[model samples]
Target: MVSKNQIKRITGLHQKKFRNEQQLFIAEGIKVIQELYNSSFEIQEFYSTDSSLQLNNKVKPDIISETDLKKISCLKTPNTCLAVFKIAPSKPIKYEGLTLVLDDIRDPGNLGTIIRLCDWFGIEQLICSEETADLYNPKVIQATMGSIARVNVVYTSLERFLKNTKQPIYGAFMDGDVVYETELPTTAVLVMGNEANGVTATVEALIQKKISIPRFGKLQKTESLNVATATAILLSEFRKNLSGK
Candidate 1:
């Protein structure tokens, strides 16, 4: 059983401010917890209703009741287990073959899907504008489906980073030339903008190439593609070129 203070502290991690203050975040479900356990993230605490669950970490989990787990869980239907892990220190951004730059992507699901896409396509780094969804947001972690453990995600100033990098920058836009027709470089920065507004003017100025996913529907009334789905198609296109297809 967990003490009232402990429950309060663990629940606090659901908020970004508290997560930052505690330098800790929560991962729920067996898969997410297992992935974090296998990764470099240091597990600070583990709480589970199942007493037999095995963990490789040196810290033995507090075997709590399902009632106790619910007190600290943010999920509507709490999973069987939840683990708290210390946030790993950010590594220096590696300017490599292809980097993903997100300009204020505010949706947690979109950010999580993008991270998974980066991992699938072998993109080494992901750069997000400071306003982008928190990397540790519970919904984002759940959406990543363990891909969060592999991808390197960082938040920084979009303008400053763009100004400093010499790599060719590409931005996805509704009016730009069809993506299938664009001459994509193997090594460059791909910028994905916010869901509703697309790219901001400041960041757009830094984009060397403007590209778009062509719509084939006769009505052509679809306002735009969901950012995550667009990311999947764009990354697939980028990987094809990298593989010399």
Candidate 2:
């Protein structure tokens, strides 16, 4: 049974301010918790309603009731387990290969999906403007599935980073060069912008190449693609080229 004090603290993690203060974040669902346990993130607290659900041969989770789990879970439908893990220190951004830059992507689900997309394409480092959604946001975490454990995400000033980078910078735009036609490099900085406004003028000014996914429908009336969908398409094209296809 989880005590009332413990419940309060766990529930507090749902907020960004509290998560920052505690230096810990929560991961619900067996897969997410298992992935984090297998990665560098250290497990701080583990709770589950089933005693048979083992993380591994070494660690044992504290068995709690289903009622207690709902109190701490962030989801509408609680998973079988929840684990609190220490926020791993952000590593220095390495501009070696295919660095993805997010320019104020405010949606947690979009950010989370993008992170998973990064992991899928083997893009190890992700740079986000300070205005981008928090990587540890519960919604983002849930959307990431287990990919959060594999990608390195960093938040910093977009303008400064763009100004200083030596690699070719590419920004996605509605009127830019079609991405399918452009010759993409294996190592470059690709900037994905906000969901509604697209890239900011300041960042757009710094881009060496502007790229876009063309519209194919007869009407061509679609306003835009979702940021995460655009990212998947772009990343696929980039990787497809990298393979010499």
Candidate 3:
């Protein structure tokens, strides 16, 4: 059984302030918890229904009752299991492969979807501006499914990182040249903008190359693509460019 103090601590993770103060985050679903359980991130605690406990026995895990799992869960209908994990430590980037950077992406769902997209395309390290939604948010965690274990997301001063990085920078903009026509470098930072504001001028000025995914079909009034969908399209282009069969 989880204690009242533990529930308070777990529930507090729903708030950004508490998550930061404790350097912890909550993840639900047996799959996500199991994936992170096997990752380098510290497993702070675990809770599950009686049936769920049989899924694994690798760790000498702390067992909590179904009632306690519901109490600590942030979901309307909580999953059969959940976990509290120490937030992965942020570190200076050592660039090697294709890098993805986000400039103030605010929506948790979009961010989570983008993370899963990164995992799919094999772009593992993601850098984000400080204003982006917390990668540890429950909605983001749930949206990522189990892909969170495959990506290392680092949030910092995006502008500084862009300016100081040694590789060619690729970013999307409304007025840019077509992504298909341009020659993309293997080492590139595919920087994406926020949902509403788009990439700021400061970062735009640093963009070594600009590319756009042109609109094809009718309904030309399509304002813009959703950030996650755009990211999938862009990353797919990059991966195809790198390894087209």
Candidate 4:
């Protein structure tokens, strides 16, 4: 049974401020918790409804009643288990090849999907503006489907990072050169803008190349492509050209 204090602490992890202060975050569902366990992330505590469920000797979970489990869960229908993990120390940001730069991506789902895409396309480094969604947000964690374990995410000043980088910089834009025709470099930075505002003028000024995924459908119909979808298409084009397969 989870103590009252423990329940409070776990639920508080749903917020970014609490997560930062505690330096811990909770991941729900068997798959997310299990995938995190398999990765380098350190598990602090594990709680599950199923007594038979086991991760290892090191991670012996507190088997609790479903009622108790529900108290700490952020999901409407909590999964079989929830685990609190110590946030892994940020890995060094390697700006070597195909780095993804996010300019204030505020949506958790979009951020999560983009993380998955990065893992899929083998993009190693992802830099986000300070205003982007928190990596540790439970919703984002759930959306990532465990890709959070693999992708390296860092939040900092996008303008400063872009100004200092020597690699060719590319930003996704509505009225930019066609991505297909533009020759993309293997070692470069790709900037994805905010959902509503697109790239800020500050960051846009630093972009050496502006590329866009052209629309094939009706003209002037869709306002914009979802950031996550655009990321998938853009990353696909980058890898295709780089691999030449």
In Å, residue 107's CA in model 4 sits off its true spot by 0.6
Q: What's the distance in Å from true for residue 127, model 2? A: 0.4
- The models' CA-based lDDT, in order, is 0.89, 0.92, 0.86, 0.91
lDDT string for model 4 (55-123, tens) is 854566798889988888889998989999999877877758889999999999899999999999998
Candidate 1 C-alpha error for residue 154, in Å = 1.0
Off by over 4 Å in 4: 56-58
Q: Go through the candidates in order and give the C-alpha RMSD of each one to the true structure.
A: 1.4, 1.2, 1.8, 1.3
- Look at candidate 1 and tell me the lDDT of residue 184: 81
Q: What's model 2's TM-score?
A: 0.97
Backbone clash pairs for candidate 4 read none
Q: Write the per-residue lDDT of candidate 2 for residues 1-245, one digit (tens) a residue.
A: 78999999999999999999999999998888888889899999999988888888777789999999999999999998999999999998776889999999999999999999999999999999999999999999889988898999999988988777899999999998999889998889999999999999999999999999999999999999999999999999888966755
After superposition, candidate 3 runs with Cα above 4 Å error: 51-55, 60-67
Cα RMSD (Å) between model 4 and the true structure?
Answer: 1.3
Cα deviation of 137, candidate 1, in Å: 0.6
Q: How far in Å is the alpha carbon of 82 misplaced in model 1?
A: 0.5
Of candidate 1, the 10-residue stretch with the lowest lDDT total is 52-61
Please give the lDDT score at residue 197 for candidate 3.
89
Candidate 1 TM-score, true structure as reference: 0.96
